[model samples]
Every structure is written in structure tokens, then in C-alpha cells.
Target: MTKNCIYSIPESFLALLTVFISSCLFAQQNNSDPKIQNQFWKNVQFGGGIGLGFGSGFTDISLAPSAIYNFNEYLALGAGVQYKYLKQRDFYASHLYGGSAIGLFNPIPEIQLSAELEQLRVNVNLEGSNTNSQDYWNTGLFIGAGYRSGSATIGGRYNVLTDKNNIYGSAFMPFIRVYF
Candidate 1:
């Protein structure tokens, strides 16, 4: 009976090893099928930010819409549009509009690195007597890193150009992103 027990133990372990190996091989084969490859536009994601605020005599509104196309598990390219309006009491009002192109790289599943180039046009109007207005364009380059969990991402970026008049308003910008 001892001899029989020793043989059965090895037989059971060998069977389990065989099952594991075959399952792994099947998964590898399935992953390599062309039909299993991601289709273009199939994994596109769309989401961005909206900002709204109201104070004693101030108002701020912003809308930014973005879209991303996943080329594979590790790379994506995207674009976005931004618009903002701000008014303070009876002082001045400003409008900012822009567009951007972005690229993302993921070396690991949960970590992302991104780069973007944007061109923005700013219009400022004085609320007082003369009703004067001025417009200008600002270009920015930003690089960033983020951590992604499921469909949400939180990140920070630094503008390399860092123009004082850039609509983004700061050298460092924090962003929250959701993918749908």
C-alpha cells in the first residue's frame, strides 16, 4: 500500500504540471492570432476636463475634449481641443482656445509617459470705457508621467516653453483623465 501511495503522488503532480503547461501554451497560441489583434479605432478613448467656477464677482468656464487611439498595448496617439472663458467683476474678460497633439508610451501596464504640443489663441477684452481688446498666440510643449488604474488616470505635466502668457497659466499642471 505504501508503494502504491508513492506512485499515485507523483502521478497526480505530473498530471497537474501537464495541465498547467498546456494551458499556458494554448494562451500563447491564442494571443498570436491575427483575429485577436486589436482593430484600429476599436479601442479609441474619449474624455477630458471641464472647469466651472463662480465667486463674488468672478466667473470661469473651461472645456477640453480629447480623443486617443490605442495602437497596441504600449503606444497611443491623440488630440484635443480646449476652450476657456474668465471674467472678473467689471475688470476684464478673456477667452482662450487651442488644439493639441499628444503621444503616450507605456513601458509597464500601469505607468505612462506622455508628450504634447499645443497652439493656443488668447483674446482679452477690457470692461471699461475704451472697450479695448487684444489677441495673441502661445505655443507650448509639455511632458508628463501618470499612473493609471482601470479607466482613470492622474498625472502632472510641466510646460517646457513656460510662457508667462500661456493659457494654461502655470509651468506645472495637474490632470485627471478618464477613458471611455
Candidate 2:
């Protein structure tokens, strides 16, 4: 059973990699048309968030990268990938990786509303005489509102499905995003 669980990680990673590569290729193909290429590049944005923490016995790190395309002034859609690692001194470690789809609405120039749906695979390893490990999947939905400036956004979100085993840690999460 453990071996089967371990195998799933590579499978999942491969699947995500395929999607990522396909999207990039598709975008490149579409760019062959000058008008479409200009419009596409103009509407596309890149941004994400990072988290870091360290203490005497523990460390946590998170990175999320995303791309967004503005369909119009009021609507935008995007995809993102996330990676996180956490460790506690001589005790245990965990790795999380996932992807998400995001939607955003801007009713005004400075306020934005957003929603995200994500699927994450988490693996935990226990360091001890027994040396046990486990893997599982977690799905989450988040809704949030934020203040948006020219190229920066700050927001807080609430996970409606607050599973105790979630790698995100809490029902509420804060984020800072900068687009280029």
C-alpha cells in the first residue's frame, strides 16, 4: 500500500506537467497571429504569493505561481501551482503540491472579489524508530475580497471546507500578490 501511494506522486506530477506544457504551447501557437498575440500578451499577468516561517524547532515555506488573463474589466480567470514544505526538529516533515483555478471580479478599480478551487496532494513522513509515512489528497474552496492597486493586491480568504487535515493550517488565510 505504501509503495502504491508513493507511485501516485509521480503520476500526479506528470499529469500537472502535461497540462502546464500544453498550455504554454497552445499560447505560443496562438501568438503567431500578430493581433491576437498582442492582445493575449497585453491581457496576461503573472503573480503569486510566498510564505516563510522559522523557529527553534520548526520551519515552513510556501510558494505559489499563477498566470491570469483578463477577459474584460470585470472578469478574469487564471491557473496556479503551489508547493510547500514543513519540518519539525527531529520529528516529522511534510510536502504539499497542488494546482488551482481562480476567478476574479472587479466591480471597481480598487476592490476585487475572488474564488479558487484547488486539489492538493500531501505526504507526511514521521522520523522515528518506526519511520512511517502517509499520503492523501485534499480539496478546498476559498472565497475572498481584496484591495487592488496598480499591480499589487492584498487580501484575506476563508476556506469554507475547513478540514482539520488541510495543509493550509486554518480557515482564514492572508495573501499578497504582485503582477507583472
Candidate 3:
């Protein structure tokens, strides 16, 4: 003969569960309310950068997409991802992918200052005499300032971590940033 088994619920657990459900039901701005959610999303801004260049045996194309949460009129925090493809005739073809975190400060309406940290994975294929493949990681920390007008900013940033063998080949990079 077999006996039936019974599991019992603790009184404390039952009371906590009742409170949780009640609080959820009485919440004024829960995620289930689309209006409140939309208000929260209104604080976010989306933006990115794109590059395309082709000339005498050289081709370069890049795209970066980013988003930011504006805490107020003067401060914002954001993140972005980038991909770049480059080819130099008979020399090498390379692909780079990276991501970055950025912080922005606007002391005045027309001036914006920024700091960004980036990390990238580089894959290169040498096409000529020493045909081979190379893979490595590169990182950069950039500090920049820009002139802002409406949704666009024209600026330049310097990478403090620049080294002779760095992928960008230069410490200073010019940029045009736009957001919508």
C-alpha cells in the first residue's frame, strides 16, 4: 500500500506573497502602463557615425551606431558599436569591430566635451609577398570637445593611448556627430 504525500506552505511566505501582489496592483506607473514607459524612453537619444572613402587603390568604409540617456540638459551617458573595413590594393585587407562607452558634458549651449573608451578586434590579411593573416586587439581612450549646433557636432578627439603600432595610425581624429 502507498500513502499520499502533502506539502505545506509557510504562513510567512503567504503573507509576503499577499503584500507583493497588493503592491503590484496598486502601483501607479508600472511597466504595464505604456504612457509611463514612453515617458521614460523620451529621455533616450539615438545617434551614430558613418564613413566611406575610396581613392587610388584604397577603400575604407565604416559604420557606428550609438544611443544615449540624457540625464539633463548638461549631461549624458551613451554606448556605441563600430565596424570598419579597409583594403589597400595588393597590400592588405582588414576588418575591425569595436564598442565604446562615452560620457558627454555640455557646459554651455554651443560647446560639448566628451570622453570615450573603445576596444576593438582587428583581423588583417596581408595580400602581397608575405601573405598571411594577423589578429589582435586594440584599445583607445579619447578626450574631445566639439562645437554643437542643433543635432550635429563638429569635433576632434585625441587618443591618449596612441602608440606607433596602433590601428588608427594617428592620435588625432576628426569627427562629425549627429543625433536624432
The candidate that wins on lDDT is 3
Clashing pairs in 1: none
Writing each residue's lDDT as its tens digit, candidate 2 over 4-65 gives: 99999999999999999999999988768688658888999999888899999999999999
| Weakest lDDT window of 10 consecutive positions for candidate 2 | 126-135
lDDT of candidate 3 at residue 121, scale 0 to 100: 97
Q: Quick one: best TM-score, which candidate?
A: 3
Q: Which segments of model 2 are wrong by more than 4 Å?
A: 1-33, 129-132
Instruction: Tell me how candidate 1 scores on lDDT.
Output: 0.88
The positional error of residue 96 in candidate 2, measured at the CA in angstroms, is 0.3
Clashes per model (N, Cα, C within 3 A): 0, 0, 0
The estimated TM-scores of all candidates read 0.74, 0.77, 0.83
* Residue 134, candidate 3: C-alpha displacement in angstroms: 1.5
lDDT of 1 by residue, 1-180 (tens): 899999999999999999999999999987795644656557799988899999999999999999999888799899999999999888889898999999988898898889999888989888884647878898999999999887777899999998566666588998887778
Higher-ranked by lDDT: 2 or 3: 3
Higher-scoring candidate on lDDT, 1 or 3: 3
Query: Can you tell me which runs of candidate 1 are displaced by over 4 Å?
Result: 1-38, 129-132
